[model samples]
Target chain A: MIISVASGKGGTGKTTVATNLAFSIGADVRIMDCDVEEPNAHLFLKPEIEEKSIVFTPVPEIDEEKCTFCKKCAEICRFRAIAVMDQIVLTFPELCHSCGGCVAVCPEDAISEIGRELGIMEKGRVNGIDFAHGKLRIGEAMSPPLIRKVRSSVESDKGQLGEKNVGKINIIDAPPGTSCPVIAAMKGTDFVLMVTEPTPFGLHDLKLAVEAVKLLGIPAGLVINRADIGDDTVKEYARKEKLPVLMEIPFDRKIAEVYSKGELIVEKMPEWKDKFRDLYRQINEIGSVKSASHKEK
Target chain B: MKIAVTSKGPDLESQLDPRFGRAAYIIIVDPETLEFEAIDNSENVNAFKGAGIQAATAVSDKGASVLLTGFCGPNAFKVLDAGKIKVVNDAKGTIKDAVRSFNDGKLSFSDGANVEGHWT
Candidate 1:
């Protein structure tokens, strides 16, 4: 089963929950860090990357020779990446979405796509768990494409990894926010585990995230970190929404200290390992029920 | 020369909008005749990204040789520069006043972008 750990707000313990869950689940489990902009799972997992591949997105390159300054490319480009002013045609590679609409609309066929390096995808192993992540290049605004690339790479490698006779569980550590990148990371997962703090900001962002997952028609549960520090509003909201509170990691100085030192909570606490395993079991139960209902339909 | 003045309304009597990308309207005028056409920029005002570039394209498409606004960001500046559209920023008052300042050479042309991208 593919499960994604996500949160709407940054620093809400998505990486913490994801890495812990990966370690608890043991072999035949793969963890993918889809937070391309600032992937932090590696800091805790410390996977020895065995393979690396550069990720590229197609950006338009205009040919001045075959180009009639017809302005067709500019008119059709929703991104405004291409501008045609009289005799001059300029293309901003950074702004291009590489939708190929400009090339299709170009009467003179003046536009062609050139690969622009956006990021890198790395695959490795850590404590018997297959690890993969996408690291976006600094200043690159587009991350969904790279996130999709990392996800596809994981999916393609699943068969090879499955030959070990161990049950497969794909854990995705998604990026923050309810934006396109977050949605891209969470897409295609069987279950979504939303991590949040108990604070008001956390609850507010969690609502947004819940809405996002609901819109995607994905089953999601909540994991409230630092559950004792803030008010019970998050729990109240979850109750009202009929969403299950899978686990609550109370606000503890030791957990904070361990996390600050780049150490996994499961390692230092040891007891939390079973708790993460329980969290996985709850997700599996929910996944089975959802699939059963889906089959009924 | 054709000049584009970012404005809050469609007429010359309207206030000159401070924002270039999210300006409500862009009034393209022929300086000699003072005849102008106001193009709505509402579509670009709420754009999630690339608003400046979209606004620059709109102004360039309107055949404006100059842009008069309060500020121009890097992305818009690049597109404007590529289109050879002279940008005169920090212009205030109504659209008519901005046009008068341009005609009188009171508004200086900007050498580069005055504000960072996504100032709002």
Candidate 2:
């Protein structure tokens, strides 16, 4: 089963839940950190990266010598990356989505795609879990492409590592927000475990996330971190929404200190390992029921 | 010469809009005859990205030789420059007043983009 851990707001313990859950689940599990912009799972997991590869996105390059300034390429580009004026045709590589629409629309065959480095993807193993993540280059606005690249590594690994050994449980640590990057990471997952705090801001963003997952037709459950510090607004919202509260980690000073020091809570407190395992079990139960109903539909 | 003035309304009497990309309307006026046409700019205002570039294209396609607006960004400036459209920055008052200022040489043309992209 493929499960994704996500949060709508930042610093809501997504990395904490994802890493601990991977450690608890043990054998035949893969963890992919799809938060390309700020992948923090590596800080806690500390997987010794065995392989690294650069990621690239194709951006348009104009062939000025063979061009007619027909303005067709400019008119067809939705991103406005290309502009044609009289004798000049300018292409802004930064604004290009690499959709290749301009190239296809160009009557003179003047546009060609050149690869631009967007980020890097690294693969490693931590404990027994196979790990992979993408790190987007600074100032890069597009991250969905990098996130997709990281997720695709899971498929490639399944083929190389043998289907039986790799497909048991794949957990994706998704980025914050309900935007393109988050959706890209959440796609094709059996379940989404949304990590959230108990405050009003947490509850507000949680609603937005829940809506996003619901739109994608994925089964999701909530994990409320620092559950005791804030009001019960999150729990109330979850109750009204009929969403299950899978686990609640009360605000503990020791846990906070350990987390601040880049240590996994599950490793420090072995008893919490059982709690994470139970969280996985609850997720499995929910997944089975949701899939069964989906099959019926 | 055809001049495009960013305006808050569809008429020449409307106040000049400070924003180039997110302006409500583009009033194209023939300065010599005072004849004009107003084009809605609502499309660029709601655009998620590349609004300035798209708005520049719109103004260029209207066959306007000059653009009068409060501010212009780098991307928009590049397109407008390539289109050979002179941009008069920090343009205030109504479309008619802006046109008068342009004719009287009271307004100065921008050397380049006056603001960063997404300045609102």
Candidate 3:
């Protein structure tokens, strides 16, 4: 089962929930840190990376020798990346969408594609759980390519998604937002564990996240971190939205202290291991419910 | 001379003015007499992928041997090179200033004129 842990607001303990829960399971698991912009899961898990691969995207290259200056390639381009004149062609690489429409329209086949490296995908093993993460190059505008690369790595380890029972649970540490990056991280998950605080900002962004999850039609549960710091607004929103609040991690100075020192919570509070295990079971039940509903539809 | 200018808005008259995604307009001014006709590429129907190819085609179509413009990325530079159009970067002040700069042979292209992402 794949569970995506996401938060609408930053600093809502998504990484904590993801890493500790995977560790507590103590089974063959997989964890993916999809926050390519600023990945932080490695700090806590300390997994020894065993493999790495570069990610790239294809951009169009126009050949003026055969282009005939017809401007056919430019005319078909939707991103305004290609243009042609009497006999000359101008191209703007930055504005290019990497779509092959320009190449397809070039009557003379003047356009070819070249790959541009955008980021790296790293694979590691923490305990028995296989971990993968994405590291995007600085100044790279897009993150979805790298996130997709990381997800592809997970698939290479198993047979077709449902054909083989890898018998491992997957915990996806998603980026904080309801934007394209977050969606790329959370898609294809069996269930979503939304981590949020009990504050007004948390409630507001949580609503947006809820809207997104509903649009995707994925089952979701809430994990309210720092439960004592803010008011009851998040709980009220959760109740109204009909989303269940699964785990309530109280605001404790020691947990913050251990977290700041790069320590995992399960390692410190041995008794909470069962609580996390129960949380995973509850999450699995939610996934089964979603699967049944999807079959019905 | 007839020249094509790359603009976001649709019209030849908007070449002297700038707007978002407008980048630079192609104005085919006569090198000897400084008189010209301009093709305003505001419809940008052909500018599907990036501004680079659009600018190259506009310049080439206008029978322009020289391209006077602001900053450009590498992909567009390759198209310009393929078309054999001379490119001058960092042309500021006004369209007249840019034309004069081009005529005076004062425009130059640095190695990094075409960087990644948008001008912003």
The candidate maximizing DockQ is 1
Query: Whose TM-score is higher: candidate 2's or candidate 3's?
Result: 2
lDDT of 2 by residue, A192-259 (tens): 99999999899889999999999999999999999998898898899998999999998999899989
The TM-score, computed over Cα atoms with residue i paired to residue i, of candidate 1 is 0.93
Per model, the share of native interface contacts recovered reads 0.46, 0.36, 0.86
Model 3 ranges off by over 4 Å: A63-66, A90-97, A103-106, A156-166, B2-16, B23-120
Clashing pairs in 1: none
- Candidate RMSDs in order: 2.5, 2.5, 4.5
Candidate 2 wrongly placed segments (more than 4 Å): A156-166
Please list all clashing residue pairs in model 2, or write none if there are none.
Answer: none
Interface RMSD (Å) of candidate 3: 4.2
Q: Which residue segments of model 1 deviate by more than 4 Å?
A: A156-166
> Can you tell me the CAPRI class of model 3?
acceptable
- Tell me the lDDT of model 3 at A119: 86
